[model samples]
Target: MNFKSIITSFSFTIVFAIYTINSQNTIGETEVFTTTNQAVGNITFTDTGDLVYSHHPFFSPENRVMIMDAKTKTSKPFPNKAWNTPRTTDDNYLSNVLGIRNDENGIVWMLDMAQRDHVTPKIVGWNTKTNQLERIYYLPKSVVPKHAQPNDMVVDTKNGYFIIADEGIGNGGDGTNAAFIIVDMKTGKTRRLLEGTRTTLPENTPTVINGKHLAVNGTDLLVGNDGITADANFEYIYYGPLNGTKIYRIKTLDLVNEDFTVTELDGKIETYSEKPNNGGMSIDIAGNIYLTALETNSVAVVLAKDKSVKTMVKDANMVWPDGVSYNHVDGYMYVSAAQVNKGAVFNDGKDLSTKPFYIFRFKPITKGVSFR
Candidate 1:
């Protein structure tokens, strides 16, 4: 795909960096798009190669969701302009969107946290092929606690289920609570698991970015369970806390089985590997897990064959890489640098984010799990 020069000022620097990175064959980083609006939270590419991204509502309240043409690099409100606009009377409008995934079946699944305007949390599915609303599922207050901050999600298209992660940072930014949620797409039934469990909660670890601790109100903001992904075959769901280093997984069958007691499901949980403080993650068809190392501004991979971790790509410009999506058609992994650590929340109430936030792509050795 040809990337447009959204901001020509950085063209020379970006091209030189890409050429330098490509010469090494470690990983080739390319800037696909740039924006001066709200920082990008999460992104996914449709079957037709159109990019869908969420403007994290943590900083701005507009353009909650958007669709960008891969070739022209022009974006517009997704689904429709009405859904993106904020309305007090309309309950169907998107309030705050973060996690998004486009399945192989031409469906774009969006996870709305509803943290803004006190709207109800919801999941909306849009058919990319038909350009129609496929389904909408609302989460009751019983499952979404007032303190919960639902962020990332993984869709199991074959089984009609989605697993979401609640960082539980709470409205006050205290990262003490966390949970794993399972939603049945067919019935719209949702269940919360491992609520406030040791496995789900954040560790007493500080989030250091570029050798500096990220803090708010004189306290380190250690986010809880944030990144999540499923294996290529959907056999197991893997996730880890943003403030923690240990990765965990459980069989999909065990998680979807309503008859299984919490204890039984806990027994099925398996500790996978000890990783760095990370943001988003994606798995390859070979079962290798690609993770964004937030502190180092690099992508790390956990080998499926041996479970050993290795740094795949390191770029100085990938500041606070928050989300990653692997595109099979282009043979590249797309990443968003949200610069959360540089936001007002961490910069003493001053937003230090550089203008024209970036979306980058790099080629991975193996094909992505979603590749067909």
Candidate 2:
């Protein structure tokens, strides 16, 4: 990420990477909250409105789970314990609770990944105000040292700490670690970064998914770092790398510095480009940085100012999108489409979006966030 400090600061990461590649979200500003996104199933919001969310078939070794009800968008089936095998395609079967964090006492901090040899892979907590289930983080086998794989997470509830991303080759092509894990959601404590850190390898470029090469044996096709978004005065941490075109950060006291020596904090890295997509990120309330860029079928934005990158929205139904949320009390923005290269190991098996994997809602032409 510090490729010669971005090739000698490349003019301050190229004018903030051209504001993160022309960051746009033009909806004529001011639309204070709106949802009920068709097919939305994994969301959260409630003062007393009861908008909880869950639905994931994405890491689908099949057996998708569910639980929705964002103001009667209606949904149910949400099994726990890695969704206990509804029919087993193996891989814990439960996928995509894809990192959600909310606080100020409403309590919502979850990040799920289950499929550790089809079981035992956890880092959980969900108490949307005592609706149940809290704490079950296990992964000290060197944080899944049996071929690592942990995705999308971020929770630093003011020093409780968390940061996970280990997009280590999945969708068959089967394992060979690539990491970034650091947890301590109050002593569940863990650590492992850039596992084999090949410059945090990823950027083989030439992804397609529903149309072709979703990369497998030509660079793991891609490797590591899925998503981590936490900013809005939370003081930095916006990550991306699932074939990343550059989007990074390092400073939560040097990525939770445990007293240096992960090679001097992976040599203190930093590069924040914008041209990344493959589901993983969410941070709004004017800290804009939402993601999903499945090869430009589009849905991207990364602007915490001085770090601007944009593509705000590019319809083609924003396909392949995979999980995002920033409701901010009704200024809606949620996305999901666990196509994941229409699986069958990156589509040589058929799934190129004839449609049925969707969950989108928009109206974001940002001025950050306008909550009234």
lDDT of each: 0.82, 0.57
Candidate 1: give the clashing pairs. Answer: none
Expressed as tens digits, the lDDT of each residue in 55-131 for candidate 2 is 44344423233445566656554434455343456443344454444555666555565553345566655565676
Against the hidden reference, what TM-scores do the models get? 0.90, 0.29
In candidate 1, which residue ranges exceed 4 Å CA deviation? 1-37
Worst 10 residues of 1 by lDDT: 23-32
RMSD in Å for all candidates: 7.5, 20.5
lDDT of 1 by residue, 182-280 (tens): 899889999888887777888887888767898888888888888999988888889989989789998888878899887887888899998889989
